[model samples]
Target: MSKSVPHAPTSFRELEAPQRKAFFAAWLGYLLDGFDFILITLVLTEIANDFGLSKTRAATLVSAAFVSRWLGGLVLGAIGDRFGRKPAMILSIFAFSIGSALCGFAWGYWSLFAFRAIVGLGMAGEYGSSTTYVMESWPVHMRNRATGFLLSAFPIGTVIAALAYGVIVPNLGWRCLFYIGLVPIALTLYLRRSLPEAEEWQADVGNRRNVSTSSMLFASSRRLPNAVLAIGLATALVLIFSQHTAGYGWLLAAAAIAGFIVFAVQVAGRLVPVMLAVMATVFCAFLYSWPIQSLLPTYLKSELGYSAVQVSTALTWAGLGYAVGSCVAGIAGDALGTRRAYVVGLFLSLLFVFPAFALPAGNVVLLWALLFAMQFTSQGISGLLPKYIADHFPTRLRAAGLGFTYNVGALGGAMAPLAGTTIAGRVGNLGTALMILAGTLTVVVAAIIGFDLPARIGRAFKADDEKASSAMTERNTTRAM
Candidate 1:
């Protein structure tokens, strides 16, 4: 008997009805996640005034959300890998929505901190499942564009929050802004009823069942106890740091020590070098991004003295730039390689920061233009991350692996708001602080992605090869079925 080649969609237009449906559902999930997440940023000033918070204290709330994000990613990723993507996605959406709604009920800073942590869990959880689901559903050839379009929802979601801020916060107040989060609860039901599980996940389920759940979760039986130890120590250390007024250095050090223990135990040793490089890249990536995402509004309103209307207008322009950059990055990733796209995008972003931040605030047109360029390069490159990281793992562990690497690396982001504010206080200028901090991190990311670190470490991108093999196997299996 002869083997048949499965037909693959070469373009988004060619994708089947189910494939498109899954993509849209995942897109909406990510979009709402973005909306909920950005609400904090938009309302940071209001929340601060209402609660009498210092800049540093206000930033800690952002860090608090980021610190707990890894937990959501880890748990939900495992669930998605083991049970099904559809359920995982739905669960994450529902989780975050509830978290968002709870924020309205917060009576104080501590109450709000705890509530936002819940939102963080849900937000990170949604990313792991939704991205994995959409990637598995779309054709491999078009995965870059598929993931890009999916992630564009993030910036667009921020724009929606900005618009909502202008309309609701001015009239109904910031609490009502969060109350709108409950609307996504309806989306979860719709997704559960309409979206089917990814075909690739369905095909792998039988084989995954043959393997022990323990091995699947930890990568080896020998690593189980060590993994548990690492998780416990890390969790304790992070919680302690998060609850206190710890400095960014202390937080980063605590996370580093915990990460080292996990590596020493040989957890997922098969992807050790790649994982390290990715974690480093992700850390730097977060450091580069969070300053803008978490602090830009504060900078504009406080440092540059922009009015609320001006702040929202500038952010909307930045959001538009982010959306355009995301689509362009997808095209670049497909045309070039993922690493190439990352390097160029990150480098350009680094260069644009001077004009974006250091320029005189009096030039409103020029300021908006510069902001667009800054976000276009910096935020747009984020579109590549979902496919770039997801491509490094097998279907059975796709969610788990992606979640672990991405969210763990996101710990660096948790430190960024505090880091940025600290630098600004010392230097007495937010623009200079942005350039110093974000620029340095951007360079580090460019070096890691642009250079052949894998080859120097003796792997020569083994993960990419494994990913290709997995894709071929999945296609063959689909045709056979």
Candidate 2:
């Protein structure tokens, strides 16, 4: 029997009603995922204090969450590909909401860690489901922009978390944060009520009667691209985690070990002078910036001697800056080629990373500027990685391929804190640790350029779309006759 091939949407408004509804549902799901993920970062110290755990222990708990998330992404990606996007998304939301709420009731470190890990599992399902849903629904012309807009939720959710830390955390406490994280569950209801399953998913399922989920993801035709994309994504994730883990001083020894290993190998090469300069600037920024965002309450209680309210206000600004950066990067990424956008953002980040670290302590304006620039560049560049994945694969195996690649990067990100913290411990300066991170960013930039991502991405996207279009037309004609 011939299949009825659906026409792809031509413009933003041309997106079918079902597709639009699915996009919004998936968008909100992602936004909440972002909120739940970032909320933990803001309240890490408080949670550590409540559990009477050391920083290392707390970092371990966070890493555990990442590991669960990585597993979730792999498993859910395959599931979403097999079952359908809507069901996978609904299940994901249920898992994450329950996990997040459980976090609020944790009585000890182990319980809290377990709860957070559950949250990660829920989060793992989100990106793969949402990315596949939107990619399938939108026209190719608008795919980049739609993907960028969908991802902008990450920063927006994070910005909201910043506000919660500044305003809600003071009034309610850490437990309340988890309670607030439950808001995303509402999105699941919206999904069930409003969103329709993609026609593509329905058709694939109907045609491939006996195919197993694992075979669908790793079948010979799909396996090679999946492995290569996942590895590339893993490398990017490593870069993100290295920067974040170092900046926050999450894992001193690991960061140092990694930095020394890189440095000893003379990885900096001809870029050493530039890298050093960037590192110096980042160090100065870190001195001024860290206290406001990472240790805001401590800064208020100890240094500036302000009340909790004042401390919250300062942190909110930092979060807002982070959110703005993410949004701008997403929008910009669609307009510029993803590769060019990322390279520009990374270079700008290198420029800002040093200055951010160099800013004098207690300089609020400089601190805010550095945070805004750093996060804007960091999250902004980071946001483009997924879009690259989406562009690289076809609808049939997009979720598994995208998820595997992206999560491999996420696994790398998971290792960042350990690496960063270790380096800071060795160097005896948070600023120096950030300097090392900037140097790494420089290396990533070179790799990105040298990698020739534009040509690679363009070829993959073009080939897949042509095949899909031809197949779709054949199916449509067969149905008509």
Best by TM-score: 1
Q: Give a tens-digit lDDT track for model 1, residues 348-406.
A: 88768877887777889888888888889998988999888776567877786677678
Work out the TM-score per prediction: 0.90, 0.72
Cα RMSDs, all models? 3.4, 9.8
Location of the lowest summed lDDT over 10 successive residues in candidate 2? 263-272
Predicted candidate 2 versus true structure: per-residue lDDT over 1-481, tens digit per residue: 9977766554557777777777777878887887787666667778878888765456555554565665576668777777777778888888888888888899987678678778877887887788777766655445566676677676677667767777777788988988876777777787887788866566555346424345644568867765664454334333443244456444543443343233312212232232232223223322322222333333233434545455555555555655566556566766777667766776676777677656655676666666666766755555555565554344555565556445534543455455455665798755556567555745554454447543344354443353344356435533542
Clash count, one per candidate = 0, 31
Model 1, 278: alpha-carbon shift in Å? 1.1
What's the C-alpha lDDT at position 420 in model 2?
Answer: 50
**lDDT score at residue 71, model 2, on the 0-100 scale:** 52
